[model samples]
Target: MAADEPTGTATLRDVARVAGVSPSTASRVLNGGGRAVSDDLSVRVLAVADALGYVSNQAARALRGQRSGVVLLGGDPRTASIAAMGAGMEEAGRERDVAVSITAVGPDAETHLAALRILRGLRPLALVVTSASFVGTDRELILAELEAAHREGANVVFIGEHDYDFPAVRFDDVEIGHLVARHMASLGRSRPAILTSAGHPAMEGRTQGFLEALAAAGYERDAIAVESVEISREGGRTATRRLLERAEKPDMLLAGNDVLAIGAIHEAHEAGLNVPRDIAVSGVDDIPIARDITPPLTTVSLPFMEAGRAALAMALDGDDQADIHLQSRLIIRDSTVPA
Candidate 1:
């Protein structure tokens, strides 16, 4: 609200507001995408804008001796969380006057290689390789690709590392598991079941820490049971059914993510469970919908937005920069403890 401060960030709206026209009208005339405005009329508007020093702020900008080359954001399109991350980071890229080119890598080797080659041909400013979730094989492949990109002097930032590492912006799922476990234990949850997908670093790490924490807290090693399934609502529903059918049902369920947690909640209702009284539930990733659930999920908070912001930061880091890992925390809601 300061007098000297600009009213708003430079955007199409500002351009239109200044030119005294609708944003769509300004867009049509400026981009020449739709209707072509009269040459003289367009010239007069542009002249007035030039006099007013009005400049359109777009993500595409030219760098010194080069156009801001496309930065490759490579990931699996099926990976929902990674898609969110890419969307968030793209905004950061725009703020920094860089263009982001996202490419979805397929499962097949031929398809992945072709996509990789095409991305390389773009002469990208850098390549940020990430996984929606990490499995051992995928992590190794991802790390290898990042190493290859690094060797080629392509700015490389890898997310969710398994073995090899490079410049990274990641959160610790292991720590998240530990936090959730300790919280549940403190609330008298001795034997907890973890619902998560197997084959990925996120699930694997969290499961490992959950079990380890249980043992460390003086519980039997076999006391913790993990139901490995796909990281989706349907997957959680299936896994929860199997878990509930066990000889002795678990006292608590720790879902790997909020979506799975939501599924588990619904499953509990189907199984004639009384939630915290019959079996408490918790999850990782305090997604937007987490708070809207019946018991309001007790879950760990992943810094997803922070991860995206960190990606752009890594992209802009100085040469010889190393990786950075952020920690996750637990958000204890009604689902895990007695009031």
Candidate 2:
């Protein structure tokens, strides 16, 4: 080794020595000890550690009874809501000086469990799970993994709907359906169809609410039709085609999400139906593209970012056992109501 070069991996003591701080103070700044450190001292210690290439041993820190300064978020990043939630969590993490790691949880039982194991191995201070739906033995096994992680000193927080005994931030999925149903009724839409993917509890809850509201409005229970398809634009298109093929076609289409709504609109146009004139369409999750389409889509705008912030706050010890319900509202656009 060069005379002036480091001979071995930099330790906490080495960092303290180079930064002119005490070993205990260095530990407080780097080891997530939960003790307050002066900003100047923290900055200097971090700079020295970075200069020395000091990589934190998270497992060692955990063994020593210190939590890692990381928050692990498990969700599918492909969806717009999850993406927005991640951005919100990142913003909150920056404010709290904590790091955020987003891991994609698979849609299936086996892959989901594997992802949970990986997250547990990371030993984050907090684990936030979202955009997942499991049932029967799969649900039980996944819950066990989460409980194990929680017992090992990680804060477990869930976003979206789950009956598990964990801190959760949930959206008003039923109310989301009610909003669409109420809007449709206001527009004098009598015959309606729902486009959604099966096996999703959140979507199912919304559909239930929609059905209840439609029933209360004096619509026959059998009058409404629900089509289950893949949760994609093509899926929406296929479902819409099937509904449009019926002898007494639906006058309005209610999609479980904006993506499906987009497909429904496309299919309606392809069949030479004028949106909001010949047929009306509405969806949940007001994604960016909702407004940019030829005739902007009417959708329920969800507070994904707020939900993200709330989830992170809970993970950071805000309130662990409480169920936080975020509100979503309806946005009227050309898709459902013509200009």
Candidate 3:
């Protein structure tokens, strides 16, 4: 064959011929069922397939009672946490020789329903959801679709809390709250204020745990103040300003996430209050930006990448009863050092 020949009409036979392998070997390697093949041979087969522009025939695979070897990951990719989860899923999918398809959608009932409808048409081997809030309000429709997927031998995995019956990779938000609060108390910061988002399960759980721990540490109800905000940088800044204007200012501010914590720090600086001096700040989900900010943030670290990998494993490996609980750890930074 000419080197410049068109590959638009390429087939598995063409790939096998180019790679010096049999058609069966090419099929096994390309279709992802040839785990016993030598690494060098597998690499050569994949490279040849790419050079020949060979694409798997999903229809033929389905006719042969085999799955399409695709996994669907549904969530908003704009969020930092969800984006990290997507990256993890993609890495795992590549290792398993499975294709990953992402469907970006908003966090609303109608949007989730629409995304689920689109997902059903794909008939993927599994569906992984990084956020439960997207499907929170339309549980009935989402659950029905999940049941149908289950009946069709497709798996469903959730990365966060959900009321549905699917397997989940959950973070210990309550425990993270307790850890952060206990750490703060250990630093002798008794008067603490919480800045959190309303109607968010993760945020609410963290707040509840923190308050409970503080109460147990001999802090009275009047000494602690909880404020609900938008769970954004601006929300943190605005809420912090309000807290600082009070007759009695809090000694520490606990934000729902790093973004809010950054905002709180900015506000404290504007007010000329030295961090860990006049006031201290802490947050959850030790995002990348947390460490880069001035006077690095004290926060709880959730295993975002591990959660994604676990969710994909549960779905692809058919571990329906798998309830993976990831532990969160407290990371003390310069922001929370005792004066």
Candidate 4:
């Protein structure tokens, strides 16, 4: 090699050294790229970079070559649905050679706008919304903004039951309610109670479907008792206390999910009610912990692993002609039967 070539190149480390800060911190400020570059550092870093003639490495700037594919999953942080779906979606992505990322939409969070802002910098191939409903938090006018992102080139997939422009693979919550209700009724359990948080769309759908089935069976609303509470185990305990306060408590209890069902089971024991003899119990979503309880919980089950695979398939095809409502099942166990 000829020794005549000039050695007049500057690196990011040179800029950091001049700025008297770490190289990573300098990069963060400079790469903020028109976003909110937290004030003082932005000015200081760029100033020092310019003074030292630190040019960004174009060779290293080739990002597309380094990535195969990326998928983003968004959901409400508080819900178990997010954890369940997030696990399945990520596994699906890994099977297909795609890197998966997750973001939780904090309470009253503007997910759509935040996602859009995030996308301008990183180009993920698709986005999966992990929950059924997002309360309309119109912070900084986010809903319209996310809608624009969907219109533009983003592939959007909703994880639960929804009717939207985006393609979704959802479980049928309505059918789930019917399955559990019919199971209880067939067991000759005349008085059935439902417990849930009405704010969640999935829970609401379950309640509606359960009530509809009862109406078909000649039972009035009063006969089909219901209690509304936060969709938590503690909330279940409290709701159970309310039911116990009544002179005539239900013989069958249908909890919205395994968590509440587990709590209701505890309450039933506390009240000296022998399960299935005094009161029977059922739940939905056959969670991992369902079988671990004293008498394993009977539940309306969903094939979530299959749903995960299908969601990615739909996302890749980018054609949603078929709104696939995957079937749910009633898993019979000791809780709803004579032990």
Candidate 5:
């Protein structure tokens, strides 16, 4: 050890000072940059660095590159689709030697933006945002922040529909809706109803496609009832009860997701109405519980995990202009057909 070297763990600054050279010069020698420096000065810096045990900091290396090899995924981790997506991202990250960090963001835009801000401090190489639709000022604010991050060299990728000109991995929500409506029509269901929440752009797209396909099957938009409710099991139950009480009831109920479909089925059983016998029910998102219920639920299976893998691939491959479209398929079960 050098007589003047400090006893504790050494830093680059310490090594530079001991060697009587600028930090930049020491950094060039240590990193083996092509920039020319005196051979004698390089040797002195290397000796000082070795004596001080000054190791390179990964975080500092990232700063020099302007971003780290860490990918930040922002979404609601509790959701099944999000969980699957995280799994896919983690798998791909392991293969690529990149670190994937998942941050839970709230449904509201304010909370979502706050999480994004915190993750930005890490200067991740990519930011993969999987969130629901945002509107009004919230939408503008979110877009602005994302654009700013892009300008700052972070790859911004969205996992859902944003309708904006950005790299995205989107599910074929309209096709999912079309599939459900076509299946119901094949079952000879005439009267149809939509049960979903407002402000969900993807769900809205599904509803629109479902309505269009149903129209082709001889049911007009005015003939079908559409109801917007909170996205919860209780909300589905309450809405189903009200629909059942109407003078003219819908023969088919298409819910936004499986949880609501489960609720609808429960409410129908309480009313002594046999699912698919008196009224048929269906939903999107083929969650695990969808297949384990009394009568399995008929819903669409979205490729969330594939989407996650693709998102990471896009970031790593530097495909910032690519818009990848993933497909969804209908899972047939007894809920929409007679068992």
Candidate 6:
């Protein structure tokens, strides 16, 4: 090799030499193959491999009929929550020596079908679905793809929805709603209203839980008003404005997520109503911004990052069938406190 050319690409032999281990031992540890190797030896080999910028030869592995260490993630990347989950998955993948590839798909039928087809073609070690729901009315096509992946020895994991038989990592959305509602009720906010995304299964489940808990807390059905909106700040603002126009205004507004809750706060300010005094507001999904906003927003904290990591672990390490349910806690903040 020319002196100007980078020293020949680092190899497994170089990693083994630097770590003082045999090439076979290094291979077993680094490749995650089933070979009895000491934890200390594995750690040393991995450390040396990282320091040397060593990468396994994919072509050679292919020739040896080894499966690629790739995890495929499908979701709408534009959403902040989904984006965060994807980042968490990537971090977990690096730690496990696996590759994660994300594909953004719209909420349309054609896009979802195309994404599923592409996922089937990749035949990755695992497939993670982070979208709210699959494309089209029927889930047959997506379910078929999942079944195909499973038959080929690939794992399938869903983030939110539990429509399929595959393993899933999901938050207890119903419980989240119940917690937030109970909090509102404890504050003596008997008149409550909910603003939520239209046609979202998880959000719908949360709404159902909230209404049930509110009713159990002596809030009559006639006293509650639930509005389905576009799942945005503007939608929340618009819906809250309508609610404010009513003669008997609600004392508490429950938003499906933080974005909507923030919008509700904005509308309250514009209407010359003081939050927590005129109307207390709360939302779900304790996003980063939830804590930064004025009079920090009270909400349900879903372990989204933990869910991402758990999904990866379930896909790569757990049994063929696993169900991981994460908890959501009520985060009490200034927004929900009565003046």
List TM-score per model, in order.
0.75, 0.80, 0.80, 0.73, 0.78, 0.81
lDDT winner = 2
TM-score between candidate 3 and the true structure: 0.80
The all-Cα superposition gives candidate 1 an RMSD in Å to the true structure of 7.5
Put down candidate 5 lDDT per residue, 1-339, tens digits, no spaces. Answer: 332223346766788799998766666676554147788988899898788776555344454554655554554577787788887886676554356777876567788688768767777888887646353128778888878877888888888877776688888777888898898888877778888777777778888878888998899889788887777789889889988888888889998788788899999999999887888999998988889987889999998889889988887676547689988898988888732
Clashing pairs in 2: none
Write the number of the candidate with greater TM-score, choosing between 3 and 5. Answer: 3
Question: For model 5, what is the alpha-carbon lDDT of residue 174?
Answer: 78
TM-score of 4: 0.73
Stronger candidate by lDDT (4 vs 6)? 6
Per-model CA lDDT versus the true structure: 0.68, 0.79, 0.77, 0.69, 0.77, 0.77
In lDDT terms, how accurate is model 5?
0.77
TM-score of 5: 0.78
Expressed as tens digits, the lDDT of each residue in 1-339 for candidate 1 is 221112244455556677777665555554433235667667655665455554443322222223233353544654445666676666566545455666766655455656767765555667776755233334455456656656665676666644554577767778777888777777676567888776666777878777777777787877677788877788888888998898878878878788888899899988998777888888887877888888899988777666766777687664467677877777888887642
The TM-score of candidate 6 is 0.81
Residue-level lDDT of model 6, residues 257-332, one tens digit each, is 8989999999999999988788999999888889998779999888777877888888787456657888778899
Please give the distance, in angstroms, between residue 34's alpha carbon in candidate 6 and its true position after superposition.
25
Cα displacement (Å) at residue 254, model 4: 1.1
| lDDT, model 1, position 70 | 37
lDDT agreement of model 6 with the native: 0.77
Per-prediction RMSD in angstroms?
A: 7.5, 7.2, 6.5, 11.5, 10.9, 7.1
Sort by TM-score, best first: 6, 3, 2, 5, 1, 4
How far does residue 316 in candidate 1 sit from its true spot (Å)?
A: 2.6
Window of ten residues with lowest summed lDDT in model 4: 1-10
What lDDT score goes with residue 289 in model 2? 97
Off by over 4 Å in 1: 1-80, 107-110, 133-144
Error of 3 at 27 (Å): 12
Worst 10 residues of 5 by lDDT: 1-10
Q: Residue 214 CA error for candidate 4 (Å)?
A: 2.3
